[model samples]
Target: MNAIIHILQTQSNGILEALGQHISISLISLFIAAIIAIPLAIILMTHKRIAEIILQITSILQTIPSLALLGILIPFVGIGTIPSIIALVVYAVMPIFQNTYSGLTTIDPNLEEAAEAFGLSRTKKLIKFQLPLAMPMIISGIRIAMVMIIGTATLAALIGAGGLGTYILLGIETNNNALLLIGAILSAILTLIFSALINGISKLSLKKIGILFSVVVVLFGGFAGYRSFVKPTVNVTIAGKMGSEPQILINMYKELIEQDHPNMKVSLKPNFGGTSFLYKALESGSVDIYPEFTGTVLESLVKTNKNVSHNPEKTYQVAKDLLKKQANMEYLKPMQYQNGYDLAVKRSFAKKYNLKTISDLVRVEHRLHAGFDPDFYQQSDGYPGIKKAYGLDLASVKTMEPSIRYKAIANGKVNIVDGYTTDPEIQEYDLVALKDDKNHFPPYQGAPLMTEKFAMKHPEIKTTLNKLSGKITTADMQKMNYLVTVKHEKASKVAHDYLVSKKLLK
Candidate 1:
């Protein structure tokens, strides 16, 4: 609890920024869903068949997994706020639409009849009678949708739409319970506050409700207009894949660039999904730069079947050339570290098994329970490569999130787990990384990846970032990761300290 309070105090500005983003996206999504669903419900009151079809579609949409939906939308709409809001609006629509329709359709028959007997026109009857009666139900629907939106909006951070989820993802990756608690608790509090606010609004008179709605519309509209037309443009937007290493690297990039060009505005989007998401963001111009690994470029991005040389420089050269020729992107000079894949086990377990190398794994393969992150489990250069190279296959394999797999191995839930060479958990858990005797995994030197056009337009930015070339070593990255993940230090501060220690920054 003290740790949580300390983090809250230290990170208050970031928390508030994330909270503002969360509120903006959630409210906008709810408002848009209301605009779409309520009017459609009212119009469909006279068209039951059409209404059923539309509602069924919404129900089907609601059943689709949120992450899957976000992935599908990325190709068409790109990432960040737009795609996040669209996905949220989809989820928010069904509840609002269903309740509004039900409220109107289920009005007391006698009261409706009395309104009709008073010679009220359809429009006048809806305004004076049906709408007022249905207001409570509409508010109830909005409340439900608002709560849902707030909860799911955390995921917006994954696609570079800044929100409270940034802390959540960072917390998970770094194993920081204080950060995780902050995100979860704040989200819960937002839910309660919005729910209570809706309840209060539900008790208001019709005139007051109308006035309140008008105010909301105006406010949302003004906010939208300001974002679209008035907001200052960010000169450089740098992003990173999930993990403390990427976050730290991007912070280094940001600091170096800003130090060189003090007038330039740079935005850092940390924990911005995985390699594919960041790559796509860069390709689509959503992000100007991100840290990427050479092996990932060869194995995942370019998908070349050509044999990659084991030499670090050769591998980076091949990746750099391929990216330039095929994708119109440039891969900058790589750092000295090789954050490649490795299989790690508890030191005691390794000692007991007499495991010293990848080949040694074959002896214990039949008894080993393996935990792996989804990427390592599925990628050819990952588990499959190990199987082919070392002729090793474990007795059981479970694919889990990257952060959870570390815990699994550390807690003895699994005998072994896939890990990166520089992962701080190797030290934290006292795990021994078995040598890759067969040299199955290629060198994975990290570098800044960006579009050639952006590089050309901002040549000075490239020059500024390349100052980090060959600067950070495996030990440096491991220590930085340890500071952020194990000690719960801020990634930005760690990056800044590293730069100052190296005399790269004043």
Candidate 2:
């Protein structure tokens, strides 16, 4: 009950904004689907062979996974509203097209003959006689399309498109069930409302329906004009990885930036495909800022295998300097703690093997089965490099989801798993993090990375964001992650509370 009130009271603005984007995207897709499908359906009535081919094509599109379709579209069209709408239109077309074809072909032959007896022109016959009778089936098709599109539209958030799905995804990432529930409930409500509107219009008299359609056209035109011409005063977009820590950090930036610069518009685009995705988005101008780690910038972006200085402060400076020279990117002050990747095993397993460090794991590694996230195998500082550095050979390695890795180790599904130092599950599952005795993995102090040009242009924005520097301690991050994943608190509220406690905001 408290969760419900929190969402309603605290997150109301986000809910409305997402709702508008969701409705606008779905409606535009449905409108486009109707325009294309209805005309094609009419043409196909006279050409059955062509109808079969086109129907097969659209049927295949419906079979493509929503996320996969969006991914494929991204490379060609890039991300955001355009690719999302294109994907939604592809998904929506078949239902409306199939229904239109069926409605026209299945029209009563006696009524058609009666219309022909009046010497009706072909165009007039379609508009005056055939279309009116087919309206019900077409409307039914549209209702199905609209509902389906609403659910699928949520996937658009994965590609950085704004919609209600953003809330749901963030909720899941941050372990905020209330935010998740609100996003879901609003999506369902929106779906039902759209379905009801279509049904109501279908039931209206022809003249009344025509009047309503005209009004819709005018309203849509005005909205398009507003979106194109009337821009916000300041737009700052912040993106980050898909986890509670990054979500909290980005939300903090959002709160602080908006509070400090009230006239500036701040947007959160968290849970990107990966760090690489965020990098590309930043480079291409889709985003202005994002939370990153010093070590990740050095290792992944710079592709450096050599370790930097041992001191955290010096290491941060090294990373910052490297970023400035190599990519013209700026690294702001880092958080107080390091969230470096670590290898962990269950407490019992560790005791039995007497494993206190990565080198210790090498002693009994050949007898152990290892589990790691896919990124571990792909990254330079991940499993393969770690194994090479430590000269260890495990019996087997399996790729697993990050969230399930802790349970896998605890349940003995895998004897060892890769983890982060700040992961809350480590304490919960009673696992032990193996020390990096060989110092193979570099330090990963979290910070915000942006283009130097952007920083120079918006100096105050940098100052507002840097308020988070050295603020979140290691224990603080673990506690926040635990609160979201274990306690089910909202990420936004968690961030807000933390800022208030720090007096970063009032």
Candidate 3:
């Protein structure tokens, strides 16, 4: 409880900012859904067959997984608030459409008939009679949709749309229960607040409702216009993939760049997703820069089948050349750390099995229960490479999120897990990284990556970033990761301290 309070007090500003974003996104998505669905429901009233078809399509859309829908939309719409809102709106439409249609169709037929008998036109009858009678049901649907949107909007954080989910994802990645609780609690509160507000709106007369909606629309539109037209002093967006390392590294990037160019503003999207998401964001111009691993650049981004030399410099050179040639992205000089993949086991377990190398795992392979990150489990250069090089195949392997695997290994839920060489959990959990005796894994030096066009446009920024080249050693990174993940220290502070210690920041 004290920890939670301390965190809340320390991060109050960030929490409020995320809350505001969450509310904005949820309301906008709900508003858009209402505009599209309510009107369509009205139109479909006279055409039952068409209404059924449209409602069915919307139901199908709702069934599409949220993350999958977001991924599908990324290339077309890019990341951040737009894609997040679109995905939420997709989920919001079905309930609103269905409920409105049903409410109108099922309204006391007598009332509708009387409105017609009184010489009312179709549009007049809809406005003066049918809509008012069906108000309760329509409000109910909106309420349901609002609640769902508020909950799901948390995922917007995954694609760099700021929200409480930032705290949630950070908590999960760092094993901070307090942070997780804060995000979940806040989201639940927001849902309740919106649900109650919708219920209040339901009680208003139709004319009042229309007036309220008009006011809201105007406010929303004006805010959107202001953001679109108003430029920041000098804005540069930097994003990072999930994990403490990326979060810390991106903070370092932000601090360094801002120190060099005080007039410049840096927007950070930390724990923004995995490699593919960040790369796509960069490609789409949604993000200006991000930290990336040299090995990942070669293996995942470039997707080259050519062999990469084991030496760090050679691997970095190959990745740098390929990224520039194929993707038109500039790879900056990397820090002096090889955060490559390694298989680790509890130190006691390794000692018991006398496992000193990847080959040594062969003896215990049949008995080992291994947990791996999803990417490592599927990538050829990951598990497949280990299988081929060491001829060790674990009988039990479970693919899980990167953060979960650490807990799994610590709890003895799994005896072995795939981990990065510099992962803090290795030290936290007393795990031993077996030697890749056959050099199955390539060196993975971390570096800032940006499009060539952006690099050319801001040569000074490039110079500012290059100051970090070959600076952070493997031990330096491991210690910083440990500080953020295990000690629950803020990433920004850790980054700043590291730079100050190295005299890179004044």
Candidate 2 per-residue C-alpha lDDT over 271-304 given as tens digits, one digit per residue, 9 for 90 to 100: 7656666776777666789888877777678644
What is the per-residue lDDT of model 3 for residues 302-416, given as tens digits with 9 covering 90 to 100?
9687887888999999999999999999999998888999999999998898999989989878989999997798776799878887887898999987888999999989999
Could you list the CA RMSD of all candidates, in the order they appear?
Answer: 1.9, 4.3, 1.9
lDDT of every predicted structure (CA atoms): 0.90, 0.84, 0.90
lDDT value, residue 495 of candidate 3: 97
lDDT score for residue 265 of model 2 = 92
Off by over 4 Å in 2: 9-17, 47-53, 56-64, 68-82, 105-118, 132-137, 159-161, 196-209, 220-232, 255-263, 302-327, 348-374, 383-417, 463-471, 488-506
- As a TM-score, model 1 comes out at 0.95
Provide the clash count, candidate 2: 0
lDDT of 1: 0.90
Mind giving the per-residue lDDT tens digits that candidate 1 earns over 1-506? 99899988888998998999999999989989999999999999878899899999999999999888887887778878999999999999999999999899999899988988999999999989788899888998999999999999999999989888988898899899888889989999999999999999888887898799899989988988987897776899999888899989999998998899989989988888767777878888888999999998998899587987899999999999999999999899999999999999999998998999989988888889999988888778999888887888789999987888999987889989999999989988899999988888999999999999999998998888888899898899999999999998889999999999999998
